[model samples]
Target: MGLIVQKYGGTSVADAQRIQAVAHRIAQRYQQGDQLVVVVSAMGNTTDRLIQLAYQVSPEPEARELDLLLSTGEVVSCTLLAMALRAIGVPAVALTGAQAGIGTDARYGRARILRVDPSRILSHLREGKVAVVAGFQGITEEMDITTLGRGGSDTTAVALAAALKAQRCEIYTDVEGIYTADPRVVPEARKLERISYEEMLELASQGARVMHNRAVELGWVYKVPIYVASSFTEAPGTLICLQEGESMEQRNKVVGIAHDTDVGRITIRGVPDRPGIAAAIFTPLAEAGISVDTIVQNASVERLTDLTFTVAKADLRKAVEMVRHVAQEIGAKEVLWDDVMAKVSIVGSGMQSVPGYAATMFRALYQAGINIELITTSEIRITCLIDASRVEEAVRALHRAFQLEEG
Candidate 1:
């Protein structure tokens, strides 16, 4: 029998009843003779609650100690899940990320997986035991505990799937599948039967929360087929993999729409458009670990240009402070920022080769009376910045414009 790696999100095992339900599902899979390795996130809002508690103790908890505290939530879930399985007469074992051989670099809050040994997992599978591993965390070379950033559990699951060479990796979450747009926003949205890795990565990075981009990238690198579905139901979900032999025409069509409302736009106006000016403005933010997104620079006039970019709204304060300091240092006229912004994106493969796609998107937003602030595009994706309040309207408008509901 082939091996399978299954990952359940926080909502899947939020309580005793939910935990028991997931355990029963895994027990059935084990009874069917598949060697199983299950990964689980902290139950429900456990991680968030832990973070809140940590901050209650200290306004700014040390990253290393915060990771040490956050890692306990997953351990609680994994152990409870193992107990649930054993209660139902199935043999199972719970292992922490370190015990399961997940090794990473020394970064505390957003550590990347360097390697996974899989020796302990192999031993459990050999002993006819189901391995229930904690997700979202690993140990550094120095043996310090580290937590991966948001959506890190998805990364943990895909990394394990690659290491074990599982037949398929299943990601269980709150949503039934990947939809053309956020179903809550676009009621007419349709779920995609399958999506290419490139398209999925773009969607994930753009704003789709069905899975993390890092996990999708890892799966693409290893050529692992990932299945996304709801843990509450058995309905068929979306499959993310290479679309072998798909025609060029088929690849050019828009596949999905993604939007992010947690965006802040900053404009550094009248800066000397000299060499390394961009570097000087951004390097400090990068050093501060503040990610900048959707950058646009206007044409230089008389050796001066306006540079605008977006960052996560949560990082707006720090980003503005750092940019203002840089602006003063570089003799820029002023720094301006707006926190009430959103980014709407459409993604597909080979979209750049197709004509009229960009025009269609802009026309739809314009017709809806949404003002576009900035625009950026990739070979397979196009993104527009607009008012946060109009994001839903813009998403629905673009969804109708692209005719994504037909499929």
Candidate 2:
């Protein structure tokens, strides 16, 4: 008589057969005496396709109307999934985010969760029915519908798990789990049995698209145990939880190497090393909603310094324009921008207070003849920007440097 929240991404229930298969899985779990709450995303590529259709119709889509159009993708998924469950003799009902009382702020596109009243969901649960709720979309305090940001469904699932006090939140995805290096980057990379929420957050922020940062942040805040497994393969996947003293925490000194290909670098060369220059340079990019990561300011001269910051490649053009304004405002000699940079990070909590770890990473990359454009370090991670084409090579070198080859 416990509650469990399971969220399946679009790929999991993309087709009719997959929906029926998911229904069977949920029914088996439901009949086993658990009050099951399911959160589902839109069908596979549905959201993307919708965006394409919208763009074809109109070049620039308004945010409010776009949310209204985008929110329908999840509705189709939830209802169909519910129907599949019912056909198999399972008492299941699909509810939109609003119908289930998932309330959020009126932020239009990327609204944050305000609260969730599970009265309707609980009613279905008490009546021996599985409550299936659409993920990502929510209702505002003013009773208007809003869509959560990208990967919002994962956030929705984690939020619901926390609200329901479910035993665990399972996030089924396309990959088996987090790996020592992206399997595509390093074919010999090994899957992690476990990773701390902190490391997971850093990884997600760095580049792991399997779990969203907002969802991981919620999980950390709520102390919710999260599992990421494959939807197609019945592989034993990864668990993300506390730092250590857990059954799955690894004994290795290094955890994983994360590489991102969609990162660009902007170097503000020869700026006067004034106190407010860094802030002045980054403020515009921040205001544009462009996330800046791994900033480095070259050692100052008598009064001159070069500062660099990382932003997503997709925002390269806008960020460049912002930097141009910042340069003119701050009196920088030159504004250098490169969209061909990739970021590679080595993340593990053990690295804190562990000497020479960063040195070892640098040596490995050096041995591979991969040029490092910029280096950034934290208490628990080391990140570097290199040529985009060498991203995979950098990851492989780091993975081997850490000896993460699978047995």
Candidate 3:
């Protein structure tokens, strides 16, 4: 019998009925003789509701306490799931991230997994018990509770799979599978049967929500195969693995289009363009854990230049404050930011080897009358920041331009 690791998102076990349904699915797998380890997120909007409750009591909650509060949501779901499994006559036990041997650095809201001992989980498995793990959280070196950021459950599952040397990691979520584009945005978007790890990494990083980017990164590094499918359906799902020796001519040059509406752009206008200026402004944001994306610097006119970058909208206030402080120190003019920005990207491994992908993407956006505020590219992706209002249009235009629907 092979060992398997599975992760269920918040939606899959949102309530009593859903939790029971998931238990049945696990029971079936267990009955088939495969040892199972399950990782689960907080139920439904439990994390959000908890955050709201915390803010109601305090404007800025303490990070350690907030993490401790947030971690309970997953614990509740996991225990309920364990009880459900036992009710169905399946041997099961609930374990928190720490009990499951997940250790992390003390980053509080965004901790990174440092190690997984897996001894406790292995004991449960040996006893013919399913180990139900609370995902998204772990213990710090100091024994304080810490949580990985949003979608951290995915990381937890993949990390466990890697440590346990499971045959495969299955991620059960609300969506049927990974699509050419978000089907809600593009009606004709097709589901991909398989995708390369590199392609999936780019898609997830570019804002595809089906899989967490960090999880994909871990899966790639460990060479672990991940299966993504819906928890509510029996439909065929997508397999993310290494690229096979297939005819290059048979593959689509553009694998998918990803868009993010949670974009915030910051422009530091009239900055003195000089060595160490960019570092001076961006170093503090990095130390503050604010992720900056799609930076653009205009040519210096009279030794003065404009520097622009994008961050998540939720981070706009803190990012701007940090930049403004740096701006004054660097003798800059004004710090400006726009919260209503969106980015749409086209991603495929073969795009860089082809000549016309960029021109095609730009032409499509131009034809759709979407103003391109800024542009960025990697070896396999091209991202354009545009007015949030025009994001859907931009995605559809690019999807059609890349002919993704035909697949």
TM-score of each: 0.98, 0.94, 0.98
In each prediction, how many residue pairs overlap at the backbone (N, C-alpha, C within less than 3 A)? 0, 0, 0
Question: Clashing pairs in model 2?
Answer: none
Model 2 Cα shift for residue 372 (angstroms):
0.6
TM-score computed on alpha carbons, candidate 2: 0.94
Report the Cα lDDT for residue 260, model 1: 92
Greater TM-score among 1 and 2 belongs to: 1
- Mark the 10 consecutive residues where model 1 has the least summed lDDT: 103-112
Each candidate: what lDDT? 0.94, 0.86, 0.94
Model 3 lDDT tens row, 10-98: 99999999999999999999999999999999999999999999999999999999999999999999999999999999999999999
Candidate 2 at residue 339, lDDT?
A: 82
Off by over 4 Å in 1: none
lDDT of 1 by residue, 1-407 (tens): 68999999999999999999999999999999999999999999999999999999999999999999999999999999999999999999999999999999877888889999999999999999999999999999899999988888899999999999999899999898899999999998998889999999999998898999999999999999999999999989999998999888888899999999889899999999999999999999998888888999999999999999989888999999999999999999999999998999999888888799999999999999999988999999999998999999999999999999997
Worst 10 residues of 2 by lDDT: 244-253
In candidate 2, what are the lDDT values of residues 1-407, reduced to their tens digit? 57989999998989999998888888888878888999999999999999899999999998778888989999999999999999989999999999988999887778889998888888898898988899999998777889998889999999999988889999988899988778886888889888889889888888878799899999999999999998788899999897666432343367777878888888888898878887887777776678788788888888888888888787888998888887888788988888888889998876867678889999999999999888887777888989999888888888888887853
| Position 113, candidate 1: lDDT | 97
Candidate 1, lDDT over the whole model: 0.94
